[model samples]
Target: MFKNGVFYYYTVLSILFCLLSCNSDSSKPFEDFFNTTVSTEKELGYAVEIEKIALDHIESSSYIGEIGYLKDNIAFVDYRFCWVFLFDYEGNLIDKKIGHGKGPNELFIGRISGFSFLSNGQSLFHEASNRVFVFDNNWKKIKETRINWKGSQKYGKARNIKRPSAKEPIIYSPDFGNLKFKNFNKKCYFPIYSEHSNFNGLMGGYKYYKEGRILAELDLSNYSDINILRLLGRRTPELLNYSYLPHHSTFNFDIDSKGFFYIAHEIDSLIYVYDHDFNIKYAFGVEGENMDTNYKELKKHDVKKFRELFFNDRPKRGYYSDIKVFESNDQNLLVFRSYRKSISSAYDGLQIYKNKKLIVDTEVPKGFEVKYYKNGFYYSNGTIEEEEEKISFYKLKLYHSVF
Candidate 1:
């Protein structure tokens, strides 16, 4: 009887210990369990026919800030010169307008920050003036309405705003900053604050997915690993763990039409796709490539300096320039950008992935930023430099058969 009682008491104690351990370690880690490293020795074998179109003739002093698709035959280009241009499918300059003044028709050009295309033929231009300008298909200024979003004292500014419909706007908070809604009957939303860092902003990859699953980037440079926040509508956010592979530098993220999340590295050539549960769905990339290999590993502090470190040449490191996704016919078009150690401002080349598999790595001409649309890719070289003045833009079409 005595021996049996002793055995039962130990079993109860063991159960209680396990419960405590599990509660203490609530967050999940994604290092060895989720690492998807690609080889740096494979060569790219896809053909992309490039064509250049000159938009500089329209406005010599203007440069392309953002490019987007309006319809099957229409494209909208934002010119930091205080105007937006409309182009046809063939890249012909169709119509344009200027909204750079404080008049009724004109807008505070400095306040015009971003734009979003709606299902209707109108586009919404978000401005720092706390208003949005609605432009019709003919480039006519239809109306300008005020928005409810104001910069949060905690979060620096709203990263982006998406209006799914006319009802309410979905505001994306910055990774390192705070986002607070003014008119809404809600408390302050999310704030990025920690003891180590004074100011916080998102590293990148801020997406609002289906059913209120917001994937936010967390800057964990102080710690070894970065964090991913899975936030619901009003409930507390669940923190997920992520680690950087040795060769991988920046981890940018994107989501497809099917709700699959893609985690792309700036230095490493490989791209990883994760399901809703954050499991590695698929991994693909090329070998002997990716700008990461060209760089020499610098001190860990170099990561904090990012651009400054490269410019000073104290410890040069490769930087991930850009990452975006285009969804079509149930397949995902992934774009990744990488830059050399010396020239961090311009992208070295772009690696295009179709459905998570590498299709091509196109080395764009200098001073061009390549953007993907439903039909094809647009490379704009209008933003900088005297030498870049020659070429305005380039349209590229990829032939998958050559891959």
Candidate 2:
């Protein structure tokens, strides 16, 4: 009898121990579980080299916006010209079709935001019109849906009153007056307007008008917004007010692995991490030169520095062109693109940041583009003065793995 009693007691103790471990404090700060190591092989300035292949015409122009690879060795490319091009793994163009209706000037290439590939060999795409379109493996249009929004009038008037500054390139909408309403592909787009007011005099605020918006779908849906936010920063109410009169606001959101939704604003350069229940986990990045200061303050003191440190130093506009998130070995890798006319002939390059710190600066030759792939990196250089357009793929070599 004593032996049986002891066994029961031990079992109870084990159960209690497990219960205690499972009850983690919900307020704990997010902990990063991955480490990043740089390559040590002489730091080649341009590590990627392109191999020329016969160019086959898929679309009228080769200005590809988004690209995705499927399980069956099929690749999808989104041409900003309102078309989706499907290719094989070997970069051979297989099929192409227009994304919009047939009209000489009716299809605006700028309206298409992103394209996504599903496990079922279908593709999903979003447009500025606030609509999401689904296509099959053969690039055939399947169905289209529009996101619903309430209180759009109030949001619209708020946007037009404040617009984005001229110096800053508008990431989302170029025209504030004709803002689209809907949440296609889980995307929310809001318009910014310029307004003259006391609280945000000469400055603008981004009204929370829309949600469930998709900008790009290279990786899992959960990683999209977080990837872009890490590249840009945050949009402030004051800054939104400066966008344009009766401006609108759009939110592109995706839930991360830990049930946190990563949100990014089109006009602002900030990224916000929120729990599944809509509670904010943390916010990263700031506008202009003050980003460094805000980052340092946030690190030194676990206090929220959203308003004081970042908003105060917001620039009139300018800086940063694109942001993307890439994952390798279960770690989130951020890539930021900055355009500087004063730099080399091709003044675009990828700034690699891990854990909110700038680590390596990989330059993309002039007229070329850089994107992160599953194994390594993909780059495409458009033909310039005497060079022909070319694309290349490379794998990243880590110092730890080599030594």
Candidate 3:
């Protein structure tokens, strides 16, 4: 009789738990915030200190390709020559060129995608054909490692996959061949995609995409001639529903000086914290004020319908754009860019987290997407239209009164 009572008690408890879950809101992935040891308290009196600037296109828009902020200079991939152009801080062109090759037969570069000066400031690196080419400041090739991408797979046959109706930049941007190398040079994070990814981001009747490898890491370092094993984050069981959702698959991440990884997905509000091995530690983030999260579902649409859906949902809706990490006043800082429907200005909204706690969330001037951080100041390449006659970049600095 005593054993029967114990079993009954546990069964009753499980029934109650299941009922609660079923009654809960299942429409969204995370209806509540995830704060494991973190707290969310908006400290007043902290404001985003901003300085303004203007842009009047200096050269033909074609010169604009990939842009990066070096410590003292700015680098641009001049497509005319298919090489990198390092310019002075004043936006004036400089003679310093990094890679000069245009095709596979060139010396060091082939089908160039992007390049940046590493954090060490002594070496430069560029991506081409799934390989990273590291170069010394004097422009000498030092290391080349081919990324073993095990997640890309062909979906249906080419004829079976659907294509978008929209034109360039809106319905599709084919320039995504290179991996995303935001700030970290020692490591980089890239998204997983279907081999038929060129078929306009997503289609219908697919069970999964790319084995759910949402994020993959490339250890672009060799410590004492020892190569660290690459990390593949296949943690995407929660993503299959929204896996190929438009404008939300791309994830943003950063590795702090402590070696902990911080990742923010486009559709979700939670910011996940992970250890060096990519094990999720905890997550903490509050949704931005006056944001839109009602994303459109996928339908088997041809090009025209796809274009209409994409344009209608892209700008009016809200999503996180990019994230960056910095060290300020001996405290770690995390800043991420977000788009909001409530804001009328063209400037993107940014949330600042000091020491893993949010202090301020506000918008800066247009073109303030941070590209470089130096001497306690955050710098950006600024939002400049290539068609505009000229352009200029501004430096951003955040001020906290409490800290």
- By TM-score, the best candidate is 3
Worst 10 residues of 3 by lDDT: 165-174
Candidate 3: where is the Cα deviation over 4 Å? 1-38, 53-61, 90-93, 99-111, 122-128, 141-179, 182-186, 196-211, 222-231, 234-244, 300-312, 340-345, 401-403
> Which residue pairs show backbone clashes in model 3?
55-390, 55-391, 56-389, 56-390, 56-391, 57-389, 57-390, 165-303, 367-382, 367-383
lDDT of each: 0.44, 0.39, 0.54
Superposed by TM-score, candidate 3 places the C-alpha of residue 71 at a distance from the truth, in angstroms, of 2.4
**What would the per-residue lDDT of candidate 2 be over residues 195-260, giving only the tens digit for each residue?**
223122112232221111222212224422211111111233323333331221333344433445
Q: Comparing candidate 1 with candidate 3, which one achieves the higher TM-score? A: 3
Q: How do the residues 259-288 of candidate 1 rate in per-residue lDDT, one tens digit apiece? A: 555554445445666664455556665632
Stretches of model 1 off by over 4 angstroms after superposition: 1-45, 60-64, 72-81, 109-111, 118-253, 275-280, 287-307, 310-317, 324-347, 367-369, 373-391, 400-403
Error of 2 at 210 (Å): 16
Give candidate 1's TM-score.
0.55
Cα TM-score per model: 0.55, 0.47, 0.69
State which candidate has the highest lDDT: 3
